[model samples]
Target: MIGSLDIAIICIYLLAVLAFGWMFYRKQTDASSFTRGNGRLPVWALSLSVFATFVSSISFLALPGNAFAKDWSSFVFSLSIPITAFLAVRFFVPLYRKINSDSAYAFLEERFGRWARIYASVCYLLTQLARMGAILYLLALPVNSLTGLGLEQIIVITGLLVLLYSTLGGIEAVVYTDAIQGILLISGAFLCLYFILSKIDGGFGGMWQEALQNHKLSLGSFAFDWKSSSFWLILFYGFFINLQNFGADQSYIQRYMSAKSVKDAQKTVWLGGLLYVPVSLLFFLIGTALWVYYFQNPLPEAIPADQVFPHFISTELPVGIKGLLIAAILSAGMSTLSTSVNSSATVLLTDIFKIETANSLRFLRTASAIMAACSIVAALLFLGVDSALDVWWALASIFSGGILGLFLLGLLVKKSAAKLAVSIGLVFVLWTSLSQMFPESPWAFTLHPNFVIIIGTTLIFAVGWLLRKKD
Candidate 1:
């Protein structure tokens, strides 16, 4: 059970973040400050913010859950980041900075047409919605398990607090808060690992031997398999997904713009992507450690895998430490949720409504509120998911898989690629629908759902390249 001291600590952390964010509310006098901070934020802060965005509570909770339930196979996804980060710095950074627009989809309109921009923007919104919803839902799981509080209530309260700060401080507030939150997130993970290690019999060496003995450290099969999540499959998915994130996602594009220069922005990408590699490995280690701990000491009740980590935190940790770790989890969710809300509002104002006036800030706040509400509702809908991490990955793949295709079609093909883009959309829709609806049907698209983006990206680029205008 949670003690008063723990509850007080959590409440104070929440209130402090809100008050800290409010200090920047006055600085958001325009859309640029609210959205990109007019490219004035330091690269270090921006980098940590980007890192926080990459690792949400989905990582904080679900990752440990995933490792506990399975092995370290999925860590390959993080392994793919360095390559994608290199590409982003080499190609995507200069391209977006040159475009110099608040919206990342601006070049799509210039290359293809308005429809292409709308298509990408809508896809981004859907992806963010899914991302936000999953983070919100996952954040609630541990809280509910620990405190016996209603998930819906936890989701709404947490959602609103994130909205308050994000709407008030805008991008500056979001970035700075994320920087602090990122540190807390990492520190909290380290503390958990240290405590877990202390409890183990042989410490690190014992845990390592145990993990290896159980085959829990293997990175999945190296054989070429498309129908299952093989190593190559995860690597491909991670590469394309990171490409979409660094190359095309509004959340990252805004971060790139928030830096002081193109060089700083490139550095942000490098630091953010590289930093996550080790931290994600740490998360996997924590999960594996939890498994060994539980295996050595079986539980009286079989809990959901996703709730195991929280169960540990609640049952095992000291009073104040539990609050601190809970705050870290909340920070993970808030940092990501706040980023999404701000970025979504930016896209809404700049891309959808095209509002850029004195009233732009008002519209952005309203849009942020609306996005928060929708995300909270979406969280409620995703409550019963078997695995929050898997659900998020699947949804992210479906919504964002083809976006990279459209972006590459524009970048690689000089001629008007509108027709090819439209064709890709039609095919993508058909492909996604068939894959999801008839995943097991041999007569239909039966490959692993993760392949959706890989196939879609290749199809769009290949088709557009082959049928390029004979200029």
Candidate 2:
């Protein structure tokens, strides 16, 4: 039983989603309209869409947990993204534009061959399935705890609201919904920060300094420590991680692709980079504030540290304000979840199913239904994992590196055969998967599995290319 205010807030969110879907539905008469919002969006809209896509329900919970446990070192993984943002515009945009295809993987076929295109699409679909599953698990967290609802019940009810609106309206509806969710997402984070700060004796700055004194500000080791999850292995390969996430991940690239021009797309990427940095700082600040609040007013022993934010919201704020925060959490979850389902659908139609044969509305609806179903099932399964961020990083290791390799090879390694590119790139993905699962012995340098994936893929591709030339 949610508070009336929280229920109201959630209702507003869903209603807005439906109305926006209707507005965009009329404009989306054919497949292109369905896939890329008819390609008329401004850069600002695209940037906001990108931001909403990346900042999901997982972050709402995990960022605080990371701050509660780790410190500024919590952001070490963030070091890889700014670099990738720049690369996405310079390398990815031009190639994607030149190819003039609706799907990112379509470029591989135009440049390499049909097999290469199919290969890229399959990789994207598989990776996205895993990612979407994780997001569903994330959103379901609130549904479970907030209303005492079962996971399957929440999955069936709330998840349908997100999936159906997206399937009917396509990218157009998704972009509009995402833009509103973005503002709410940022506002919600800030609201949490204010509430946590207001309840504490001192403000955020004082608490932050207090946290530093307690060594809660640790950023972990900068030097590579394969055995330590907090060490520099992730940072070492952070640059390439940025590349693949922003450049090759269709979940992101599709936002840019929706822009009417390359310049518009580039601006969207830069704006997202600029704004996201500060918003993340606010999340970190909220975590530190909660750290202090807990010390002053101790929590129950059985409560997990990760639940600090929720506990505070439920207890500290007045019922109405608490309701707002609850809606905020749902906003964060729905924002990313909707984007994932929609992107997965787009990739299935244009990239995976290769529906390039027909540019009709019928093809678009058929693709959306098929792909959305797959995403819904995948998301339902991944929810069992307890740590939201852990799932994100593991998914990153499995696919991010390999996707980066294919895009880079397509963009820069001009003469590389498509079949060779797909074969070598997937081999790298397989190697990373194996390395993550096992090591030579107990003493083996246990690098950040993400580091292992990116480096493994790059090395494998270069060596494979050189070997083939020699032969």
Best by lDDT: 1
lDDT of 1 at 23: 99
Question: Which pairs of residues collide in candidate 2?
Answer: 73-219, 133-379, 226-446, 226-447
Can you write out model 1's per-residue Cα lDDT over 1-471, one digit (the tens) per residue? 688898999999999999988999899888888999988999889999999998899999999999999999999999989999999999999999999999999999998878888888998999999999999999998788678899999999999998899888999999999999999999999999999988887999999999999999989999989788899999999999999999999999999988999999999999988999999999999999999999898989888888899999988999888998999999999999999999999999988998859799999999999999889998998988899888888888778748888788788788745566557755775676576787687657666778877887787777777778867
Tally clashing residue pairs in candidate 1.
0
Per-residue CA lDDT of model 2 for 8-48, tens digit only, reads: 77677678777777777677677777778767877777788
Output the number of the TM-score-best candidate.
Answer: 1
How high is each candidate's TM-score?
0.97, 0.91
CA lDDT for candidate 1: 0.90
Candidate 1 lDDT trough over 10 residues, lowest sum: 416-425
**In candidate 2, residue 449 scores what lDDT?**
58
Tell me the lDDT of model 2 at 270: 78
TM-score of 1: 0.97
